[model samples]
Target: MVEHSNRKDSRAAEAHQSSCLDPFGTWKMSNAAHGFGYPSFVSYNGLEMVWAILFYVPRWLWKNWEAGKVSALRMDLNLGIISEVEKKLKKKLLIDYMYSNLKHHNFWAYRYFFCEFLSLINVGGQMVLLDRFFDGTFFTYGIEVMSFADRDQEDRIDPMIYVFPRMTKCTFHKFGTSGNIEKHDALCILPLNIVNEKIYIFIWFWLLIIGFLTFLVLVYRAAIIFSPYIRALVLRMRYRRVKRECIDMVIGKSYVGDWFLIYLMGQNIDSVIFKDVIHELAKKLGYRSRDIGET
Candidate 1:
């Protein structure tokens, strides 16, 4: 009787598996059979073409530029928090503000940095369709800082509470709102956890790292425009007062007259404009100029 019951259970399991493998199931058995074709996998290919033909393309093809800029800004903040010990308190405060005050806003800033670019690329069409379909919804959420109490600080500051999964890595969260807005939030952290959540987070963390590294490599590979060696050479010697006599010792004796002036000009432009920009951004953020240059 036990043997018969075991056979019946085996059959039931198989049936259940078959049901899960149904094409219309939320989770497909295998992606191999989907007939979306290579066009579906193409990045900005057909989509761009369609948008351009429809005259809906933004000037300078900058539709995604805003999203990309936000991602970069978030990355910069994450990198600063991960590396700068002094900024820990400030970072914790910001996170606390986010957690406590954030609600479902018009733009879902949570998912911008969390979701993998590849995943978004694959699901872009459906996402765009949803945005087009729903254009009047808005919500907000907050991610407040929850940390351990610190006795050393007079203000009783909390130790930064990082929700790390098994593997130390970054995480992204993506969501859309009823107001036809979408946003992404990316958090960079170390790989500590090894479980499912950690695995997923690490996947995105690795993806971002790989993407940044690839960009550097490509910049280096284009030797004519700029190479890594040239960049490093320029960076080391650019701000220094390089008299004409000492040019050959650094940056190669080859760049003598206009090129040297151009390099100096580049440095000057960066020094002046970037300082002003930093000052403005700091003012806007209600931070001091010292904060802009910190770490």
Candidate 2:
């Protein structure tokens, strides 16, 4: 008798679950599993707007650098923490401010790296938001679409279609003339979801690409900071004409911040002129016994 009662209770629970999933199950507005994407659309649209502005900051920083006098970026006396220590050496504080915007190159480079990291975080946050919006289906969304082709068409349902259905059913209720209730089923063709489907599909793949690239940038910057050889190698690549000894000397004498500032200055100045600058910088810095690298 107890086993029979247990079975009955299990069945009741299943029925309740099914009914909860479909409040109007009797009228049968099927294909409601998507939960209509998101109950509220405001948050997801706001996240997309944030993603739009993500790349603009680094672009603006680079643009302002266009006006800097290339010759003023010279490392005449020393390197590192130019904002405070180098103020006495500044014949033209305004021009120095243009190029030596940060206290030191390491700080600028670190900030730049943080920007890359923030971009990665932004992508991850958006992906998580999308997963929550779509009820945990968005995480594997792109992978599922790619694998959709390999599966047998007989039983396979397109994830995209499942998540963003072109047609959905709605159950409507009304009162008849006899004061009795009547139910009606209606199919809705979501023309907007057709566009939405394409938009999110592109965003899914694009964000993956961007996230991967940003991660690589972070790794590359990390290597440059931790490994002196990498710093020297990158400097060599920047100006092949710059001497190997000079590159090693600069990398050894300077810390990550100083190295980074010089690196950015290299971008604005001509390579031949940059080679002379490095050569002169190394020659002058060699005479100083004080090691500011630790500083």
Candidate 3:
């Protein structure tokens, strides 16, 4: 009697677990024959919704506000006060940070760097999410698809077919008129996988490209942080009229944060005014702009 009761309890526990995992019923997913689909889509859909609303959207808006807004620091400070600002730029004075939070006047250099870092994290996270959702096959999915052509025709089973089967069996349970249970079985065909396979393949390649580019962006950020040459090079690319000697001297004296502030200033102010500022800054730092009076 105890053995029978234990067997019944075991079956009840399994039923409860299955109901928790598949609340809508397993008949929608699989039957006794095969189990190709997973319940991961529920988590994946929730992830997309929560990640976008809580994570991506707020950062996107903040980044846009920070980058697209005007810089009063670029416009307000001129040669008249270049002497004062030059002192601040060269040394970490007590008052330098007082003006840091004024409207559109932030250096935002480290914020920009961290945004790039988040982008790397985002790409990496999506890869992991896909891998988890696809049952760990997503990492090598692209490779398997690419190499499928080289295999023997008979041996070449499309990876998409295994990942997303076109056909499966379903079983449904119901109550009969006599109070007994009724079972209904049917074979289901998923035409959607035809389009889904192609879509996921494209996403796989696109993620690779985005991941590579984000890594390069991080590398570039690090390069500018460590190398003054790269700092000057970036400034030169933005405003051509700033004399090379002035840039070299200015960057040589400027901290990475100050240099980054100047770099961000490039997009806001006029190039001619920008050139004049560089020249005056160089003069304040006791170096002359090389191309004197040259347009």
Candidate 4:
């Protein structure tokens, strides 16, 4: 009786482990076939449509406001106030200035970086686990353009958009030592019963617009943070009399340039270049009596 109880417990534990280990199994059924299809149109009462529009319009307006702030930051950088601004802030490094200011002024900065880090982890996990270890299939639906079949037609190549009830399947082969092959299939179609084509189109369009605006905002923020380094490079080029060797030596050995480069590399200050630069700066700044590389 004890042996049978132990065996049952072991089986249950094994099943739990399998479910935890399989990524698809957690969200979907294990070794089961699934089919998804949508109706041509979904019925939505006037009240529901009105409510959706009301909810989305405010969100869109807020997003635009945030984007405007980002654009202003970019314009400021373009006008060449980076060095002046940092000096006023009493910060030597652009990264330090940006980090302190963003943390104090914008709560979204933390959320944005957190979301980006999470997205990277999610993508990395999917690429390694799902793409490498799952034999799976996916299907999607879209409208295709068709040309007029009749040659005599005035518009011989009349471009007509036709929405057909169609599906496409893509499969990824699982990696394993076993010779046996296993397959899992999943299917989906557009214009689901819960949402009409108009709603779908509106949602997709707004998502794309928001994504583009977010990208612009990120670019603007990056410009603000790296503007000093960019200005340095531009000035170095503009004043061509400064020899390449001199620039290299200053960049590789100077304290100030080292801090700037560390900021450019996202605060990774443990690099060899950073150490050498710090050592050089220490001697120049009278922080140390001995020069670098000297016994």
lDDT of each: 0.32, 0.61, 0.62, 0.35
- Candidate 2, 245-283: lDDT as tens digits: 877877777778767767876775545555655665665
Evaluate model 2: give its lDDT: 0.61
Backbone clashes under 3 angstroms, per model: 43, 2, 0, 0
| Among all candidates shown, the one with the greatest TM-score | 3
TM-score head-to-head 1 vs 2, winner = 2
Which sections of candidate 1 miss by over 4 Å? 1-194, 220-245, 248-295
Model 1 scores a TM of 0.19
- Ten contiguous residues with the weakest lDDT in model 2: 12-21
Candidate 4 residue-wise lDDT, 45-70, digit = tens: 44346445644554564465445434
Residue 199 C-alpha lDDT in model 3: 76
Flag regions of model 3 displaced more than 4 Å.
Answer: 1-37, 40-44, 50-70, 74-107, 174-181, 289-295
lDDT of 3 at 261: 64
TM per prediction:
0.19, 0.65, 0.69, 0.23
- Residue 240 error, candidate 4, Å: 34
lDDT tens digits by residue: candidate 3, 1-295: 6974454334323221221124543223332222334433455457658546644743784577576533545534333344655644532221133124322332556676777788788878888987887767688789988997898886566777666555655455678999997877665565666666787888789889988998998898899888889988888777788888888877887767777667766665555556766776666666853556422
Quick one: ranking by lDDT, best first? 3, 2, 4, 1
